[model samples]
Target chain A: MELVRIQKQDFSVTEEIELVKAVSKSIGGVVVFLGTGRDISKSEEIVRLDFEHYPGMAEKKLQEIRVRALDNFNIIEMGIVHRIGKIEIGENIVLIVAAAQHRNDAFMACEWAIAELKRITPIWKKEITKKGEVWVEEHP
Target chain B: MVKIRFFAMLKNKVGQEEVKLDVPENISLEKFKQILKKEFPAITEFLDKKSIMISVNQEFATKNTMIKDGDEVALLPPFSGG
Candidate 1:
């Protein structure tokens, strides 16, 4: 939960922030990006979503992104956790938390990490709907 | 025997998560893709170079990338997860 975690269980935002704060020293700002599943996509009512990731590769890519952020920014604590399996509408699916001595580093590193994670990480999702299903092929 | 892994809709179309591809040694990723094209011709649109991405040994690969013995290759569709 400190660096990188990919799990099926839901995560506690409070616990995550506390851990980051507990571990880091003299951090001025903290930025966290919490991603949630939506009730609708493309105007279709999505009941829930089934998330699948390429086991080993997904973690590797996530760690790679994390490392790149560490190298580029002056961040102190960084944690990226993504949840798999079935996730309901409005449920949290992923969390990105970055702590830094400066507010800019915290915000920029947080944004950059998620952008890279969404771009390359091999985690996938299938939106299950009453009309059947849809494979979500793109992300924001 | 090289292992070809699939994910998401690609896995569903192939009816499984992975398949063993039998091929000569040192084939380019492009050629192996052609082999896959012949094997699962039903979903050729997913095979388009623009739509699909290849990872060799867990690193994103290009068409000229070579496949070696016992390499792990994955054909992925456009990723859609946060």
Candidate 2:
């Protein structure tokens, strides 16, 4: 099974690669996406961002997403890490890594994983702008 | 008894995260919602027009579904996360 974690800790690129390598023996390709806090929202300068989650429910939902990805894809290994609490502009927000015996599976699974996470996860973010902070709403 | 949970904006609006109520036996979700509104008058405005998502036993559910005793129901607004 894949290892999934939703935490409020800082993650390093080197650490993420190591985690992926630990699960796959003959991995031909690995794809990773790191989402960062942006500086602008609705044409306004964002100073910082705040994230909140329903502790237990958030972790449970992430685990369900991880299981669904494993069942649908032929990837050998996957790791997802999402940060919580206050984050500054340009700081890392989420990380996803998918490893597979072939490049296509790695790339596609990674893309699908993050998209589903954004769509289904219960974590909420508020953008701190120059004027005031506003909680973001779902897009479509 | 069923435990009803709320999150995010709904929690802030309701001013409470969870509540336990003894709903009528074999009650539909729609009726349960009505009962909730009667019990918590403050939530009526939010329940009127907001597209609140329901979760029965941690899975997404619809309004017509039947809820049983001891079921854990959650009211979630549209997810706003990345």
lDDT of each: 0.89, 0.81
**Quality of model 1 by C-alpha lDDT:** 0.89
The TM-score obtained for chain B by all candidates, in the order given, is 0.92, 0.88
Summarize candidate 1's per-residue lDDT along A7-124 as a digit string, tens digits.
9999999888888878767988999999998898888999999999999999999889888888989998788999999999989999999999998999999999999898999999
Any runs in candidate 1 off by more than 4 Å, and if so which?
Answer: none
Candidate no. 2 TM-score: 0.87
DockQ of each: 0.88, 0.61
Candidate 1 lDDT tens digits, B1-82: 9998999998889898988877889998778878888988965778875968989998999867999889999988889878
Highest TM-score model number: 1
Q: What is the clash count for each candidate, in the order shown?
A: 0, 0
All candidates: TM-score: 0.96, 0.87
Compared with the true structure, what per-residue lDDT tens digits does model 2 show for residues B1-82?
9998887677777788998989888788889889978988777876776566777887778767899999998877767666
Chain B alone, model 1: TM-score?
A: 0.92
